[model samples]
Target: MKAMVYRGPYKVRVEEKDMPAIEHPNDAIVKVQRAAICGSDLHLYHGMMPGTRVGMTFGHEFIGVVEQVGPSVQNLKPGDRVMVPFNVYCGSCYFCARGLYSNCHNVNPNATAVGGIYGYSHTCGGYDGGQAEFVRVPFADVGPSIIPDGIDDDDALLMTDALATGYFGAQLGDIVEGDTVAVFGAGPVGLFAAKSAWLMGAGRVIVIDHLEYRLEKARSFAHAETVNFAEHDDVVVHMKKTTDYLGADVAIDAVGAEADGNFLQHVTGAKLKLQGGSPVALNWAIDSVRKGGTISVMGAYGPIFSAVKFGDAVNKGLTLRMNQCPVKRQWPRLFEHIRNGYLKPSDIITHRIPLEHIAEGYHIFSAKLDNCIKPVIVPNAG
Candidate 1:
């Protein structure tokens, strides 16, 4: 099998690797049909995420066909199409029982707090990822959602991560009918966040980003109102004006570490004075949201922390929710939405490339070229 292996920072190589097999009674082996690069994967590429070992597989967003399943895996079988959740959780854990799949107590012994993630790092359990011809899915019954007949693999792929995260963000932010929502960033997750906000009955969905191309894509594809932060003299002012000076009822920081404040020099005027939040987009979203509003952060963050105005966060009585998405809790709902016509997450996918050309895909996506939103990699291409 040929798998994309993480060699080092800004380095990934397609290398021949052993094929995966059913490792546990509850496990299953999947032949990957489609996989996509995620913004969280960028954290690994840039060396910001810790514990990523050399030769480890590097993808978590994928949908595929089940090639084999262990005896205990009764619900799924050979030839079943499935989407694997990015977070691997034991369904029987204390946290999992409470619907907190991201904080499952039975996985990732090395995780600083709780929960585990696929292909994230050693700290999240050194499980090989699905960025290859095949992968072994532990806890298959709990992690792999069977794709319904007639659904395209590309469409189902979003359920693996981005769609679930977007839905989770909306759920955590307490987005209700008639609420105005502002989402920071226009990446795949951000786009979905905006879309989810609308589906969950938001009165208005405003997406903010520096890139005109992404904002445009969000507007056209997701029907979101976009704000081009790069063109605005004051983002908060622009947002306030858009929301009639009350600011948004709910704000989501989807850009995480990639925001302007992280690269301090990129920000101008008042933004320069702040130390920038650990996940900089959080601060940006916090400032842009109305008082007493809720802020949901679904962006990836590393161990190294940054500073934020704690006093302001407290003073405004803002409700801050942050962390990796609890895929187990959200996947079923997203899957149901996909099964119906309620959510079209596939609209965010802008490029499709063969696995052999993954390096090219990475280059173009990492450079944000050609208005790339999401790039899906087909592993068995000729």
Candidate 2:
């Protein structure tokens, strides 16, 4: 098997690796059909996530066919085509029973925060991801679901993480009919968040980003207004101006660790590693939303201190909701949305690369070259 192994910051390569096998009674070995490089993977690629060991593969969004399954796994068979959610969890746990699959207590040793995530890092349970020919899926009955008859493989792959997380972010917003929503960042997650806001009955949607290409996607794919924050003296002020000076009814921060706006914050958080992650986006969300409005955070941040505006949030009576997305929890509505032609997750996929060219794929995505919005890895591509 050939897998993308992380060597160091900004360094990865395709290397031959041993194939995975059923390690637990509930485990299933999957031959990966499609996998995606998520923006969160860039945190591990840039060595921002602690405990991201060298030689570990980094990927979480994937769809595959089961090659083998342990005896205890009864929900699926060897030949089932499935879309595995990014979460690795036991379904019977307290959190899982409550639909908080991302915080399942029985999976990760550090489950006090996030549950097992495929190919994230040792901090997230050290599970190998599906950026290769094959991957090991634990708790097979709970996570992976059969790909529906009409769902495209690329759509299924995005549903595993980006698409699901984006919808979850919108759900957290609790948008009322005719409310105005502003989304920070214009990546895949951001674009989906903006699009989902419309489905939730938001009267107005604004996507903020520094790149014009992504803003263009926001306008076309999301059919929302765009704000190039680089062109604004103060983005939060701009949000207020557009919202009639009261601020948006809701704000979603989809830019996680590497948010660029404040020089000092990015330097201390992203470059110097002094803090968990840059709090610029979250702060912008807080400032851009109305005093009593909601703010949803779908961005991936490390488990450490971030200088967020907690005091201001308290003062403004804002509802702050955030968590690693419970991917499977969002699938039912997502499937319906796709079937109704209301959503197409694959529309954001900009590049597809062979497994062997994964290093180049990483470079292109990390550099944001070629108008890259989303990149998929075809492990079995010829």
Candidate maximizing TM-score: 2
lDDT of 1 by residue, 256-322 (tens): 7556553542242123322212455677787888899999988876542456766778999999988
lDDT of 2 by residue, 1-382 (tens): 9999999889999999999988889899999999999999998888778888999988999999999999999999999999999999999989999999999898899547899999999889999999999999999998999999999899999999999999999999999899999999999999999999999999999999999999999999999999999899998888888888999999999998878636776666667766656778999999999999999998998754656899999999999999999999999999999999999999999999999999999999999999999999999763
Q: Model-by-model lDDT, in order?
A: 0.81, 0.92
Q: After superposing candidate 1 on the true structure, give the runs of residues whose Cα lies further than 4 Å from its correct spot.
A: 262-278
lDDT of 1 at 363: 81
Clashing pairs in 2: none
TM-scores of all candidate predictions against the true structure: 0.92, 0.98
